[model samples]
Target: NKRVNHKRVYRLMKQLKLKAIIRRKTKRYKPFTPEVTAQNILNRSFNETKKNKKWLTDVTEFKLKNGNKVYLSAIYDLGSKTILSYELSSSNNNQLVFNTLDKAVKKVKNTKGIIFHSDRGFQYTSRSFKAKLKEHKMIQSMSRVGCCIDNGPMESVWGMMKSEIYKGNKNFSFINYELALIELAKYIHFYNTNRITLKMAKSIA
Candidate 1:
């Protein structure tokens, strides 16, 4: 009956201290296993005195006003405190990570035995990415399960970058995807050549 709606029933139940029991449905999908995994060779030892000795990489996302998201995969050199290379994509798949690594490696002559550390992201743990690292002769170092500190430096850099770009704002959605990309590219250049360097110089001076 129209008189026996949900609101009236709920109110009557509340008055009588009555409650309904509900059972949650079980998930039907199985757990996914990555094709490859590596040891945490970096082991939270984030310090490095020589350039290219250690590099950390990760992906972060930016949401646009149009409800679309862009992915940025970046590599940060620990010793130089510089971003070696970064790639932006509409998809956060293996290609984004691969392109960033390839771009960075092309600029360097010797990548032999360099400690390339990252979290156990599916893209990083994929077979193809492992093969790419093997081809470059770079060492693979992954953060141990449940250990975010193992990839702390890269996380911290991401924080600093967002803080400066967003001006302490949260969820700062960009108006246009292309313009957002341009802003990101400009910020990276400034961070490497001018902005963050100036801050570091000032702190040292």
Candidate 2:
């Protein structure tokens, strides 16, 4: 048996153009038509002194093995940088966002004064979702049109999650939609329990 350096093997693979093939997921959701647009109350202030005072929500899509997409809607607490609740669905509809919000409200002790921020996506701007916020007596905030940086923290969560769990991982291409959901659930648990951050020096859990 002969030994070959891993670097040389990688170089050879690169030279042979034998890199992995990963399909880029495209955004297929309908264009957002704002029924109601809230002001940028969050104002790029990604910090909250008290828990449940400020929260962020967003949806990110994942492509499964069967060429179908699944959306993950999550609510993140700015104070603790914790994911309060999340819902996975095959459709990125208003119900998905509303269900995620419902879950978060149930888990939290107080929701009357929480300022929930999100992009001006159709799901967030829908009249029904606005009514849901009002029903909880929560304040709604929207990121400025076409400016994602206004909701930078929530975007960071999606970026970090995909990089760690889905990107460059060949296993995802073979996993069925149901298993992908399960895997995402497990990853969310690990993220809240084991992942450490410099801001808190502790897991978000």
Candidate 3:
């Protein structure tokens, strides 16, 4: 009855020597500590005069037709509006971020003091990533909690790229993880080479 309170029902059940079975989840909760954190040094400043001075990065996912997903982590040069490097994996982990950063770093020299901005993801906040930033002499910056717009440019890039990829081929599907990775790679190449050139040409026209 609506008037019956939970406590009274529990007391009655206990008096009657009855027990209700409850289901509990099999998984246990795990806690982790972030190895590093930093201030919002970028602070919504999306512009930079030089190519390597400011870099933005984030991870996004692609859903495949078979209900699997692929994680893609990428670094974009804020000044150049260019995709410096990217890595796709089935798992979203620190290694994905590491590989993308490594690829971007391998292509550039003299990376001292460049501001690298990202959301406060565990991968970015890890001790290993902090050490990598130190090794490269780059500055680490993180967005405040629950503030996606703190890294607006990076978020916008992921949105734009995902839209363009699907818009270009409505019928096509990333049927599997490997195929998703391949398609993402192709789209990024086009984004860097063809799409950017066309946008620049349009601006000039």
Compared with the true structure, model 2 gives a TM-score of 0.81
What digit string (tens of lDDT, one per residue) describes model 3 on residues 99-180? 9999999999789999999988889999999999999999999999879999998898888887777886745458898778
Estimate candidate 3's alpha-carbon lDDT, on a 0 to 1 scale.
Answer: 0.88
Candidate 2 Cα outliers beyond 4 Å, as residue runs: 1-32, 167-174, 202-205
Clashes of each: 0, 0, 0
**Given candidate 2, what's the lDDT at residue 145?**
85
lDDT value for candidate 1? 0.90
Error of 2 at 198 (Å): 0.9
Candidate 3 or 1, higher TM-score:
1
lDDT tens per residue, model 2, 112-131: 98899999888888888899
lDDT ranking from best to worst?
A: 1, 3, 2
Regarding lDDT, does 1 or 3 come out ahead?
Answer: 1
TM-score of 1: 0.82
What order do you get sorting by TM-score, best first?
Answer: 1, 2, 3
Q: Root-mean-square deviation of each candidate, in angstroms?
A: 6.9, 7.2, 10.0
Model with the higher lDDT, candidate 1 or 2: 1
Q: Candidate 2 clashing pairs? A: none
TM-score, per-candidate, Cα-based: 0.82, 0.81, 0.79
